[model samples]
Target: MSGLREPYGRGADEAGFTLVEMIVALAVFSLLSVLLFHNVKFGVQAWRSGSARADELQRSVVTQELLRRLLGNAYPLIIKQEALQPRIDFEGGSEAVEFLSEAPVVSGGAGRYRFKLFVDRTRQQTDLVMTAAPELASAQDNSASRTLLVSDIDHAELAYFGAPSPGAPGRWNDSWEKQSDVPSLVRLRVSFHASDPRTWPDLVVALRVRADVSCVYDPITARCRGR
Candidate 1:
C-alpha cells in the first residue's frame, strides 16, 4: 500500500498543467491570433486600394488619348444663323470634318464624323459626342451617326482663342460664338471624379485649327493664346 501510494502521488504531480499555466497559454494564443488577423486585414485592404488606383490610372490614360485624337483631327467650322436656324458650314466650304479615317462604302450608310461636347441634362453629366454629318452622304441613307464618349464628367468647357474677326481685336472667348469665326486654337478643359482627387488628370488640351484664306489666320503666329 505504501509503494502504490508513492507512485500515485508522483503521477498526480506530473498529470497536467495548473489553471494559471493554461490561462497563460490561452492568452498568448489569443494575442497571436489577433495580431495575425490584423495583419491579414491590412494586407487585403492595401491590395484593394492598389487595384483601384491602377484602374483609375488606366481610365485617365484612355480619356486623354481619346481627347488627343479628336482634338488633333479637328477641322474648323462656321456656325451661322440662316433663317433663324443654326447651320454648320466649313470655314472654306471644304469637305465636312471626318471623325474616322475610313468612309463607309455604303451611300448614306455612315456619316461624316464630327466631335462635340455637351452636358447630359437627364443624367446631369458632361459627355463628348461624336456625330456624322448629314449633308455628306455615305454608301447608304442611314448616314446619321452619333456616339458618346467618357461620361460622368463633373465639368467640361471649350474655349476659343484667336482673332474675333477681320478688323476686330484678338481675344479669348469662354464659349464659342458665331462672331468668333474660325478660332486659331481650341482649348479643352475637363474634370472628372475618382477615388483620389489628386490623382485625377483634370486635363487641359489645346488643338490647332487649320487656317482659311479669308481669315488670314496662322496658328503659329496667332496673337491669341489660352491660359
Candidate 2:
C-alpha cells in the first residue's frame, strides 16, 4: 500500500507525454492522413473516368440508332419519268449522301423528305450532320432543318453498292452515279479519336427497293429490266 501510494503521488508528472514522443506521434498521424486522402482522391478520379466513358458510349449508341432509322427508311423512287430515263435525285458519295427518306407520322412529319448526311471535320473536331427539306422545297429552302447526329468523331466514310449497269451484278462503289437506279446497299463507318474515349461501330443498311440486273433487249417497250 505504501509503494502504491508513492506511485500514485507522481501521476501528474507521468500523465502528459514527452515532447519527443508527441512529435513522433504527430508525424505518424500526419503520414496516415496523407495516405488516406491520396487513396480517396485516386478512387474518386477512377470513378469519374469510368462514368464519363460510359456516358460517351451511351450517346454514341443513341446517335447510331437515329442514323440507322433514317437510312432504313430511305425511299426508293419519288417519281418515274417516261419522257427520259428515270434519274433519281439521290446521290451517295464517299463522304456524303443525299436522298429521300420517309418520316414517321408520330414525329410530326408524315411524308417523304429529302435528306443529306455529311461529315464536318475541322479544327481537330468532327460532326455528323443531317439536313432535311421537303420534296417540294427549293434547292436552298429556308424551311430546311439540320440535325447534329454525332460529334467528336475522328473520321467517317460512306460506301454504296448496286448493279453497275443493266444485266450486270452489283458492286460497291465510293460514289453512286447510276442516274436511273438506286443503290441496294449503303455502309457507314465511323472512328473515334484515341483520346476521345468513345467507341463507334460500323453501320450497314439495305435499301428496300433495288435495281434488277438481268435483262435483254426489250422486244416491246424498250425498257431494260427496270424495277
Please report the TM-score between candidate 1 and the true structure. Answer: 0.60
Best by lDDT: 2
Model 1 per-residue lDDT at 183: 52
Q: Candidate 2: global Cα-lDDT?
A: 0.76
Question: Candidate 2: where are CA atoms >4 Å away?
Answer: 1-4, 7-9, 78-83, 104-107, 209-227
lDDT of 2 by residue, 10-122 (tens): 88768889899999999999999999999999999999999988888888788777777777767656334456566665788888998877764444777668789999878
lDDT of each: 0.51, 0.76
Can you give the lDDT of residue 100 in candidate 2? 76
Q: Candidate 1 clashing pairs?
A: 106-138, 106-139, 106-140, 107-138, 107-139, 107-140, 108-138, 108-139, 108-140, 109-140
Q: Pick the candidate with the highest TM-score.
A: 2
Error of 1 at 195 (Å): 8.5
lDDT of 1 by residue, 1-227 (tens): 65555655777777888899999999999999999999999999999988987886787687677666555545444333334432223221111123222233443435335333444435565555545444334556665666565556665556656665568776666644444334555555656666425244444445445532233323554322220
Model 1: residues with Cα > 4 Å off, grouped in runs: 1-16, 77-112, 123-148, 167-169, 179-181, 192-202, 209-227
Which consecutive 10 residues in model 1 have the weakest lDDT in total? 92-101
